[model samples]
Target: MVVSCGLLTANKERVPLKGIEVEVEVKDHVAVVVYTQHYENKEDKAIEAVFVFPLPGDAAVCHFSAKIGQTEIVAEVKEKQEAREEYDDALSSGQQAFLLEESDQSPDIFSLNVGSLPPGESASIRLEYVTELAVEADSGLRFCLPVVLNPRYQPQGSEGHGVKVTAVPASLVPYSLSFSARVSSPREVLKVDSKCSLEPLQYLNKEKTQAVVKLAAGHKFDRDIELFIYYKNAHQPAAVVEAGKAFATPGTIIGDPVMMLSVYPEFSQEVMSSITTSGEFVFLLDRSGSMDGARISSARDTLLLLLKSLPVGCYFNIYSFGSSFEPIFQNSIEYNETTLEKAQKKVEEMRADMGGTEILKPLNHIYSQPCIPGQPRQSAEGTDGHVTVTYTLAGHSFHDKLSFPLQPTEDTGLTVHRLGARTLIRCLETEKGEEVKKKVVEVSVQSGVSSSFTSFIAVNKTSREAIHGPLLQRRIPGVWSRSCYSLSQQAVVPMMLSHSMAKASRMQSHGMARACSMQSHAMAPAAMLQGNTLGVKAKPESLSVMDKVKHLFRPESKCSDDPVPTPAILKHPDSLLQLVSLQKASGCWELNPALAAALNKTSKELEQPKPPKVNGNVWATVLALVWLHAFKLDAQIEWKLLAQKAVSWLTAQNAPSMTECIMAGNTLLGSNVQKDALGL
Candidate 1:
């Protein structure tokens, strides 16, 4: 019998014995799928599981299925090498029957064809796989294997999902990244070396369906290597196909939608060039709390690699953010081996401290600077007449953490104390109170969500660039989506703000509305500074449209469902639950582990001997209802009933606070969800 089995680690995350972690995010026309570390554990033990990938194709829907495969090896052990006996034994059992097939699986997800192949001699098979996005330029992109197995077994009791990275042992760090792996092209075998160099040019024979992998033993048992396959780079080809698919839409609709863009002779190339160049000429850095372990180490390593790759005189800068702001070296710098090597040392010493986020301050610092105009700065080891001009571009900022300010860093210990004292210095301003602009990023990886927030202090005087690309583009993308872009933009905001402040004060102190209207596609600070009035100095744009739209047209949001059906609610329960225990485990002094768990449990207990299975979709329903309110879903239902039912269950749990209890209580109505408890 084929029974469901999976590997579970601490915290209940899953690791399928032999499979890849895949993430899927559905969008309007396309799905942004992320494939992660290919599972590389195999001892020839038999495995049978089914995988299904639903590739939304142009002509029609196409399905790719991967199956379990098995192959046996036969080694002759004869001391006496008699030609006649050797020939007989070799002829009798040279070939072992190889079987490969898929077991049951979800219809939407697919597994590639896994083949049963013996070592040395490779066999050809007609196998199909999903074509995924190209993550790297390395030749390992297009991987083909005779057999494909679903990686990370469905998280035991949980739904099938990608392998959770943080759950794996450190030793099993994914050497390669996997994201949105789909196979439109057919090939066989996975490839990548444990160490450095891979086989030379033309390693892949166009005619051969599979390639033989040879490995020399290192730390593991035998001199063997694991095989992994990925889609090779065919960017130009993929673009053509995608374009064709896009064009095939009704000519009228297509024409109307992209008429202006189509007129640009080189729009596609220009767009692609921008994506590539944005980073080619960037200074992605990080200023989060934990810089210990490999956080700072990994970041330094990446910066070194990035700097070393820059073309001569390519511009860059180095700004550090925390409770206080300063530049490692003030201004946007030019690239050179000498400066690169020197900067590498500075980056390595980065550490974590309990400080507020001044993400916007740093970017503003760079924007405000009077550089060597376009002249590149000399190396950090300057022995010349020019004094190194590192500045303390300090600014006062607000933070939620200020309700309980942390002991300042040695560098900023006195500065924060001074600022706190300054707040009370002016009686009129003290009554005004500080305005807090918290920048947030919501990251959803697999089924989990994580959020990071940084405050933009209203005091107006700091500039520090606070984020960076430490991991590979493919790695930590979830974090990137949630936090990266916002932080990057936030970083730029201060630079633009400060530069505008200088420029406007110098020329004409045009008011804030006009300054805020400065518009640009790409955020090049120098370019943005030229016309910074509209965005920062202009009169406020009509808030009327947004106000009217919100009032008149309310569409049901993505997350919430309407009020729960009467059937889903119950009157009483045997015992109520409270995650006070779970809350304590999280190591925070003040927190509510969310009352949903307790309420869900109580709902089950209320059903008593025959408890109802709370529909997982109901969580989605609750989310939808909350979104509906956000989206202004105007459909009417008895809001009171939902609040009461949910609250009844929530109250039974006896939450620590009314806030927590009310938040949980609102779930039954699936309407009016509060802000704090929701996932980013």
Candidate 2:
């Protein structure tokens, strides 16, 4: 995906970023992407334009070059400060220059400076990076190209700064985009799917292991472009060995042959059945203003499911932060009916009204809390950061795994080694010794990977045409739009929020008391109360069945006299969410109207088909499993753990007639799920 930031002339006139062309080549699990951004100066003065964009967090930018007329200047890796000095010197000497650097706060963000472009001049920027494709839950290799970058929030007195973005609505963006991909793998390419329009996949080989696809013509730059590529035997392990740079010094990473290994482990049913029931589960949710709309709603729904899925004997706590933080309880509490209900109620009331994104304080508070004896804490958040494991869900399947090793292969260049070096530099930068810093710089320079201490700089020293006047600085504006997925949407908002918060901090720098007041307001509780209560009490009553039916068929009227309608009708909670909500803390479903509604059946119908000796809970649970396998297979990633809990509960009960229950459930639900599918 191309995050193309358009250019603006020094006088604030449009410099017209002509277009963006993206070419992606996928070899097995790794992708090599090349982006060419075209720009032309239409005005009558020399201007220095800046472009800011984001890449995949883990991508390694191995190449950056600029072509002006017939001259192409390739950048070289150097210390960030040295590169800045060189760029400034080149510009001062009336020569064209280019500088690229990674952001301090986030590795994924990058800034490119095109210095001293004479009027009527045109420049084409060529940037290349390499990243590994993520595995989706449905066993598809997922690739995404983002078009929107939301703001990030920065608190006062923060050390690092955020990007300053002048947003342009997607509809108003004036640039064209072209995207295409060539994918080849040892395994057969089952198919490729996307939410955006795409040309039909074309197989390039008789074995169907190589194919090509492209985004359809006239595509708009609104939502992110997501491509899900499925392959037969996707989980099968494979390796690629990339040959090292021939001319580089031997003994260095660049001169060594690198092997990339991909492994997906499968656990036996016995091991899966032995899931740990003990842990201190701490959930940190972001309630920043950027999270308004579908983003907050999605988070609330995911939080509710997690609360319901917690084991009965475990302990858990809920904390939400924006500028401030609030906990559902004073400390972690044992999971039971009362605690689960209270947490669920509080989660349902969560809103994205917490002014800014100041997460440090809440994170510190959580860490300060005394650890429960023998219960390790697992903290889950709704923001971007380090994660040990990830579970992905496609339309109807789930897969999990992230890291892989690099091997030696001809014509692969040093992409794998550069990526590895980048990873190592990041790890060592977190250390506290001069030796660590030295090693990080060494690896960054040797492997040509941009890092916190290094940057990419190039100058047109051989150009005959010279820039004669003082250059005016210009900032390019990128299209800002809403993301299709809530998670991706969250990623877009924080960059802008961070910019605003940083501006606020600068404005308040002169007055300590004012800064303190702003900070106080940011941290002030939205609905904090004494004792165990953290959120407003649950609604005293729910809508009646008649009211629900009316909600479904209700006509829109602007009249204020009509009672405020409920949030949803028969479609509000959705069948999957409704079924998950009815699950007890013990992991079994209770036979009830809500459960029947989720399954699109009557309570009587669900109860009548159960085997004579099977427990009602067992029958209800079996129906839930059948519905999941038959209808909600695409969301298995979300419900997998919870379903496992139900299976374990059933196994402990030694429930009789499980096969009969499964058969009866299949018949009642019009599904053909087998007993083994439900792990009976």
Candidate 3:
């Protein structure tokens, strides 16, 4: 649970939002949260207060209501425009109304309107939402309550104004928050951890299947609250059946029981051992002004790590966008020593100098390029707000469906069904045609989940006596945490996006057409620009595709055997970066002085302990794997794919004395990493 600043009037007057009480229930992987906000108006006139906040992007908001004295009015879903009109009419008629709507641009943002609160009147607003928890790298279920409201940056001439927030220091916030959570699972609850202070967990039974925890008293409305819940045998399959509303209309989803099934499939060791060595990896980086401080720095570091980890013989390119876009190369170039060095240099020099976040043109440009035959396309996006990794298999599209074969409970709530309906509606949002939109609206209304076309509205109709007064409107400001940049990077997994191409014939036949259709979208003519939007002159000497291809394929007159020069920017690289930089494109590290330096050992010492029959490359690779497992387990998510590549390369070698090599490597590094841990 999380809470932040409350309501404010148009004149910057505080609306005396007393406190917030939040209760969370976690059953398996899904969480149901209810927030109750208490607002009191001490002003002489009636006022309307609007509060904007953030929620999990995929959350399903199923219930909203207002309690004023003895009356409780539950909200009903209606069309967005109709709800707005009804609320406005209620306010004009001197009746209290409440409206809650999702933001059009970002699914995570929401605005709640409390209309016509008379002088000396108090109101309690209840908002309940359900969301599935995300699995972290260590198998912990992550639930975050975001209280930070970083200012959103809108491109110049965009449709609506950006969210304006008046943030103060955490200590200066006026409101208090009370929060508690109940967690239950079929397996034992291993533990619960948070960055915020919390009371000791109380187990309800000896099996440790259920527990309750609460936030410590005197919590300031400040940083986002994050909870990581660990369970024994976290990947075990489970299912839950929830009954629908008792009085719901028959034949509808609300009238039927819904089943939520969770599955964790185990793949064969042979299939899991192999990783793709060929692909077209494109990285799109955001350089907007909002990304100025630690965000850009972290982006640069991440880019360096990725560039160092790319496989040999793959096609790669980088694009940076803001008010304008720039490409490192005219076309995608094959990965090699020269190309990798060039990209690394450019990445190190990149800055957040671009004016605005104009991503459409760059995306269009990327889509217009032809896909290389036999190379599946993958795109990774790095942005301050959201990080996305999209995998595009050439000719085939993959869809996942779940099956439930167990009996459903007879008495339960509709939360599970509502969440499922929200998921379906969002999936259909991008499809064309009025029929699709009609389907989305129908599902939204039936499940009581608000969508782009619908909103939740509650009005008090019992009181006919008009309380005449001026209605002042207020927009509550959300607080922005100072440590947002570091916190975001800490939680981010690596941006590696790769897909295996099981069929080369399919990739050659229909890959380009499928890739084009999937990537390209109809763009507004105004945004289809041939130059920068910030009045910067375009480069006149950009190379054509044919010229780039010719240059890429051209033979060098002379080849040098000298080692690749270490970038001056990384003169004193960290242990992790240094070891990563030494890895070859083929996913193996050469036995050299640089590798020894990265491992904090002398070259002579490394060679002295190597097995007599094994080659240097295998020994070096084994040592690197040992080091990674021993020291960087926390970053397993980011390095997992690369490590898989290394393992595949090692397996292909069929090196002798593998167990002896791993033991010697571990002993040399003073770490006890086993062969099985490195997939030997």
- Per-candidate TM-scores read 0.25, 0.60, 0.61
Tens-digit lDDT track of model 1 for 1-680: 74434443343332223333443321111223333322222223322111232221110111112221333222111111232243323223331221211112221222222221122222222222222211122323312211111122221244323422222332342223222222223333233333322342123456433343332212221111122343332121110101111233343211111100000011232332222111213343444453333234334433433343333444565555556666565555654545554565565555545254444665565545554543322113432212111211011111111011122223211111111111112111111222321111111111011111110011101212221222111111111111111111111110012222222211211111122211111123222211222121111011111232232233422221223332111111110101111111111111111223323433332122221333332332233334334433221111211222232333344434444333443544444667443321
Comparing candidate 1 with candidate 2, which one achieves the higher TM-score?
2
The residue-by-residue lDDT of candidate 3 on 280-327, one tens digit each, is: 777777787755654565466556666666666778888888799998
Candidate closest to the true structure, highest TM-score: 3
The true-versus-predicted C-alpha distance at residue 66 of model 2, in Å, is: 1.2
What lDDT does candidate 2 reach at residue 120?
Answer: 88
Question: For candidate 3, what is the TM-score?
Answer: 0.61
- Per-residue lDDT tens digits of candidate 2, residues 83-164? 9999999888888899999877566678889888888899999989887665555567777775555344333343344466
Q: Candidate 2 at residue 488, lDDT?
A: 23
What is the overall TM-score of model 2 with all chains considered together?
0.60
Candidate 3 deviant stretches above 4 angstroms = 1-12, 153-160, 244-257, 266-405, 432-435, 464-469, 483-585, 589-635, 647-680
Pairs clashing within candidate 3: none
Ranking by TM-score: 3, 2, 1
> How far in Å is the alpha carbon of 185 misplaced in model 3?
1.6
- State each model's C-alpha RMSD to the native: 29.8, 14.1, 13.5
